[model samples]
Target: MRHFLRPTVALLFAALALLTHRAHPAEHAVVITTTSTLGAAAQAVGGDSVSVETILPPGSCPGHFDLEPAQVRRLLACELFLRHDFQSFLDGRLLANGVARDRIAALPAAGGLCVPDTFVALGRAAAEALAVRLPGETEALRTRAEALAHEAQTRGNTLLARTARLRGKPVAGALHQAAFLRWLGLDVRCVLPGGDDPTPGAVSRALTEIRATGALAIVGNVPSGRRLPSTLASRGPPLVMFDNFPPSPRACRLLGHARPQRRPPARRAPRIAPCRTRSSPSPTSPSATPAGHCWTTSRLRSHAAVSPPCSAPTAPVRPHCCACSTANSHPPPAPAVSSAPIRPHSTGAAARRGVAESA
Candidate 1:
């Protein structure tokens, strides 16, 4: 009876210790991240032991964001600060004033996409950073990080398999997410200029690039183009739009995760030859290729390079170019292909619908 009593008393003590460990919160480490994706990674890795905050709002562009004083104070007080190297160093300068400099951690410079692999990588980085700062919780943080990484990698693999059909499709994109789209196997034809409305010349150049590439869809940040839709593939591809970023750790709402009504495929064979107009031409600029009849027409129709009004009087449009010679006298080249064109990155900007498969 005495021996049994001793064993029961030992068991009771062990059980009580276990309960205390479970019931009490561990030391909490406050972490600050530049983006929500990183913030979520920190949260996943930190689990119940860390507090995570992101300075940037969801869907905001990193290039345009500025740090506020309150955020600066929070940043200076944080136990750990995580960011991607591509993020502006302005925040770093603010945090590096003293002993706080040691707290700053940057994941390797990457495209900073919200892909599953990216999230997993970020998780690993955060775990490693926190392990250094809070050595007591090292084991738990590492375990959580590994679990997150494995789960993310598994989902990423599935997404790749689902989107495998999109490979080699020529698509235009904003410079911001171009690398990710290319990784998904889309032939990125041209990278659009980033930020708000571009100038007329910029728009014209974009049009020229699109015509040159014969891209079928313009996949990019929504609101990328200045005078798109009407001036863009009006008679061609429908604009495919996507929002900038997911608001949470969950997969993007559209793209591979959700079944947004798929845009019907438009199969087109654009035959517009590249046109090189001189500042001033003597009647004979390059003519339509032997394979083409007439190449391009635009809303701003009359440039010198264009031929006179279309002989088809009631035709929907006439040809035009500025300051060039037209010898064959077939109307100036009208843009041959109607393809979807996407927009550049803007936080508040209504971005394009994503490839139906990405961040």
Candidate 2:
């Protein structure tokens, strides 16, 4: 009886320890992301057990965000950290700042889990990692997530439908939101050239090409410099801006509209002409006479011997010294002058004179 009692008491103690380990709150101190999407999922699974904080504020660009020292201190106190794969900037920073690898749970790698799907998967993973069953709210959170996904899909479909009406039209976007635009079946014309905040020259060139190709719209991601859209707006096409990471409800609203906002034309600088030079004709020119004879001081000097008698003008004696004599003898009714400068070597007298003398 003593031996049986000892074995029974040992088994009871072991069982109690297991239950305490499972139910202990600090044993699973979780740091879900501060970003609302992931934070919501953590809450879905953690229920009343875990603490979460989003590292960034609303409307901040995740990629360019910097971490606060207080957030780092909070991260050090956490027992478990869950992050969305490939999208959590804070997760990368935390890991780089000496967070243990095993303490983190990366979401499953599969398509179709864009946002809401991700939230559901995260809840399941977090519950499993903590070695505890999720509270009753797990099913409710899943149902809510599914409903949100359905709503997103419906909105996505509506945008796709509107885009389908205009086939083969070009569209433009900043780098981060290029995929979203392509997913909607719009032809991305030119990527916003160089740097997160595109330069005015780059924007101008892109808009010029877009206008030339008659692109239907310009799409940009949020957290981007306002200058990009403002610059685009001054040009012809309307712009549609979307969110990059942790997409917002406003993105849905913008997607539904699909129509570009009207903006005043961008002011452009005036173009200037290149510098050049021009030469003027000589002051002593030829004068018309009876019988249609004309003589200039330069022409007369070159052909002193064969000059037509200024009075008789007998067929304007062909000036033997220059090729101009032929045109003089058979002058056209109306002569046209070319703007091209006549070179000294190309003159009729220069050609007729002895080569050595001319040179």
Candidate 3:
């Protein structure tokens, strides 16, 4: 009984210690990112060791976003700041706000986060930066970063296999979205002009390229395409828009894990009714003229040559070729051809000469 009591007491103390560790964990490093892309990469590598805060909305255009005073101050106070070089607006603001240059880590603006290789590169860069700032968790961050990169590569390969059917399919897309489209194994023939509104000449050129390459669809992005969507949709192939940012950091694993939405079924064109006619005389018959028939003269001639009756109506009247309904009545006779010589009209002097000649 005394030996069993000692073991139970030891077990109780171990459980209490485990709960205590979990309840009061180490403080997380404060990470600030200008965009969700960088924030996602940072979080993916840092995991629970860092608390990531994104300055720009994931859906907004990163280049055009305005940083508020509070956000600027936050950037100054954060343990680390990650960003891309494309946000030139931040250069002046960060300098004026007295934010240390060493605090900010700039990433390249190359391929989108959706690409597996690009995502892996982003993870590695993020891990390196994080490891430098948080030296205590360097090994853990590096390990997680490698795992993340591996997962992205595996998922991307799987996606590539699944999208085998779409490989080499021609597509037109926005310049910014070209990388993602290429990653999806699409053949990007041309890119649209940059900005909200494109010139008519540019639109014409894009249309020409689309026709030449036989593009099945035009891919657009969420940013800077205000009028392009409607214009392209009205004049070109179907437009599909891809998002630039993921909804969450975890969603940045090349592509989100969510199942794709099913496209709506296509609408079929209404079928037309077949034309019907009655039996007619042979082509040799003089009365086989097509003056009253809805069918063309050549068609009537061919029908007369065969001397077979037209097909009978099998459905409602919505004829595509001709509008004439079933004709049970006989066809009208052909006009007579005369061989008489021409004569002058009898009037005035000509009338007197004509009377004399007749007499």
Candidate 4:
């Protein structure tokens, strides 16, 4: 009887331990995300209630993300998966990998939750899903988020106002960014030549027009690579960099509530030195000047006479007279001049140039 009693007590203890383990299951929920940006948002919302796992690392191209087998399994085991509808890589893969629709949460539709508002709401929802109660102090967090949203709106307005000063001015950049700037009231002349990166030639041509028309700004995604913005900045006008992701605190702070940099007044190129010819009576004299110091054939012709009636010793003779003299003087060599008309390339021409012009 004593031996049976000892074995029974041991069995009872083992059963009690099993029951205790079952009663106190793990407290943390698992959250799976395709990118760190989304993972950060999930963590913000989940707070201490959930652990986040990002399948893609920072700075990785979101378009071509591929999940590992282990990551897929981990995702399947997670309590929830947060996804962005526009995320091509993650959304399709998750569905194909057999993740149930019910276990996923799509972000609020566009226009519903923007910037800081989206972040706060997502955080609250994640906490609620885990049955985690926020402390009374959470009211302060809510207040802060509201303040941030107001500040963002104010900043956006300020940016728009500055941009307004250059109303009707042409702008060009990434397609999505162009649309955003357009929404802010900018006249987007065109998108950068390629879908993402513009070729060197395309950039050169675009910059030429942008400079010619005096574009108000050249906007692009900051994370797209600094080369584009750096290139644009060096060329002319100011580059108004925009973040592709919804504004985060970091982004908001970077953009700030300050008004956009005032569009520096356009600087006109200095007039070229008037062309002079040796055939003229006073070869050192200035050539015929056209409107605003521009040299034209008509103005040059007006200045042609080599004799004294041309009056001013400093006045230049007509360009045609100089050309005629040159033709007679040097018959062997004709000055080569291109007959091509100066016209802005059509969109199709620019597109073709874009391919050949890639940096």
Candidate 5:
């Protein structure tokens, strides 16, 4: 009777445990990231271990984004939130919208200059925080983050190594990227915005520095176009517009590869104003054109003409001239003018004259 009671009690305990297990199932962590940059890294690290959602699309300023009802719902459901400088980003938006503060996690903010080094650093932090939230994914999350970091660092060093040729070449760039420019081995001489908005004092200082450093290349932010010093505009340094931010975090890897156009050697071919010849070719003949300066010069030589009139800059200057052999070009060649040799009064000269005369 005691043995029977023991078996019955054990069976009842097993049944109760099975019922409790069925009542609660494990849930995947829901992650919400504010920016695409952080969201991309989170996704790379989280893999399938966590469900990640992004709030801001690339290129949207945080101040401009107002949360919609659907987005707010998505945010409230998330178990974790990642943002660069989350305090300023979220403020009380999530809390006021009914999200518990405990679930939100702020990793260290990686600043501007979206090079691989910056991303790699942020990835590790994001992965670590995520591991804490989803203990079951600790190993996978940490491993993925480290692997990402390692690969990025490797790619960064390789990029730096490849850019060794740019070392010591002085440049003036957007204030935010001065350090990064130097890191890539560029010599940063003067920064733009010059502590000055085209102010006289700023202009004076910038010009002086430009002279001092011989900085012929001015790197400007792509977003802030044509804002260079007006005084320096027509005759200033070659303004190099740099796109600091790519469309997405995944594209951030392309940083540092942008380069300013190098002034072509002093012998760069002069720009040719597009011009069409006054004449057109016949149906049976394929028309040919001469190179710009060469064509102009050759025509001028033949015309013994005045300076080529400056052709009105046609809208969308097209290649009005196809490069062709001067032989096939317009203005057909002058027929050869041959003269018979003069006959000499004496012996050998007469023979030569006879040969020339074909007699």
Candidate 6:
């Protein structure tokens, strides 16, 4: 039975797996992108017409990313590839693997994606490129691109207006964050030399510039690594990090409105019943023991074999007992045991004692 059960279960699982695979077949053409920004843009424009996948991890820096065999396979299988100009790895390594130039789309923008104008331009460019490959959804893609661009512009304007008072405030930051900070209307005092790890001389120079300019904040690029010289941060101002790549094109809509963290519900204290004794009839009875008095060990052991007292409301009164006190007047004695008979010892001195005696 056990042997048959194992094979039967395996067959059932295999059938379930087959049904699941057939239930949802691959429907959309795969689109591969070097960074999340490209993937997001493609998703915004392409909609359900295409499936977008990013080669680079969301938290990784483009310069630091190393391509794997799986990523190469993905690029080879994808119908379209999207990338930015700064991603040199594609040119040196990835594109060399028989991936044609016609399939690739580059988003070359002078300003950061966070800037309204640049964002709109990127969306429009992405729409145009994607519409060429996915012709059936051209009108829908164009409409979505226009809507996305409009949203970005409106939100960017509102954010800019809110921070208008900080238009000319001096700020030190990474080169990558300069465009976004400038778009937000801050005066970029000095650009940090390196991405994550800068040389000692560069850090000293940046620190000197920050101190001289009296920069109020240091903005860092999230993808490039949100780290700066300790001396610069300590002596200068607060370090603020801005992400270069959003998780999705629509992700910018969530900016400024931080999702409130959900806290766990408060726990309740357990209820404890009041202790009672055999003498107590009720909590309020005059003859009952005081409130904290409890049944002792001896009291519990003595009444273990005996029935509950008549004083207890649940216990029935005996026929002979007229009063409840008579039931508890005397406790029953413990059971006695008989000992074995003593035998006479065979030794000479032990015989006189009539029992075995130790020397």
Best by lDDT: 3
lDDT of 4 by residue, 1-359 (tens): 99999999999999999987654333346767654345544544343445656553222334444466666667677777766556645656777899876677655424322233343454445444434223432553344334433443444444345345545557665553454445445577756544344568767877887777656556544335435655765776555433333211112112221111111124523211122222211101111100001111211111110111111122222221111011112121111111221122222344324322321
State TM-scores per candidate. Answer: 0.59, 0.48, 0.63, 0.47, 0.54, 0.61
RMSD of each: 19.2, 35.5, 31.1, 24.1, 27.6, 32.8
Worst 10 residues of 1 by lDDT: 283-292
In Å, residue 26's CA in model 1 sits off its true spot by 3.7
Candidate 3 lDDT, 1-359, residue by residue in tens: 99999999999999999987654333467887765556666767777777777664323466665566767777777888888767665777897889887777877755754455665677678888887777878888788777766666555565556456677888887777677667767788877777656578767777887788888776666544435754775697765545454322332212323211111123422222222233333211212211101111210111100111223322222211111111122221111111221122212344335323422
Candidate 5 residue pairs in clash (backbone atoms < 3 Å):
none
| Model number with the top TM-score | 3
Q: Rank the candidates by TM-score, best first.
A: 3, 6, 1, 5, 2, 4
Each model's lDDT: 0.48, 0.40, 0.53, 0.40, 0.46, 0.49
lDDT of 5 by residue, 117-181 (tens): 56666667777878777777788877777666655565456545545666788777667556556
Candidate 5 achieves a global lDDT of 0.46
Query: Which ten-residue region of model 4 has the weakest summed lDDT?
Result: 283-292
Candidate 2 at residue 339, lDDT? 21
Instruction: After superposing candidate 5 on the true structure, give the runs of residues whose Cα lies further than 4 Å from its correct spot.
Output: 1-30, 61-70, 86-89, 110-112, 194-212, 222-235, 249-359
Model 2 scores a TM of 0.48
Residues 219-319, candidate 1: write the lDDT tens digits.
44532333343345453443333323333221111111111111112342321111222112211111110000112221111111111222322122221
Per-residue alpha-carbon lDDT of candidate 6 for residues 62-100, written as tens digits (9 for 90 to 100): 555456666666677777877776765566565688777
What lDDT does candidate 6 reach at residue 35?
A: 57
Residue 126, model 4: lDDT of 42
Per-residue lDDT tens digits for candidate 2, residues 1-359, read 99999999999999999899877754345554634345434544444455544454323443454556655666676766655576565566777888777676655524322222333454456456544323433454344434433434454344345346444557766665455445545577766653444576777677787777766666554445445655775676655444332211111111111111111123422111011012111111111000001112211111100112222222222212211111222222211111222222222342324322321
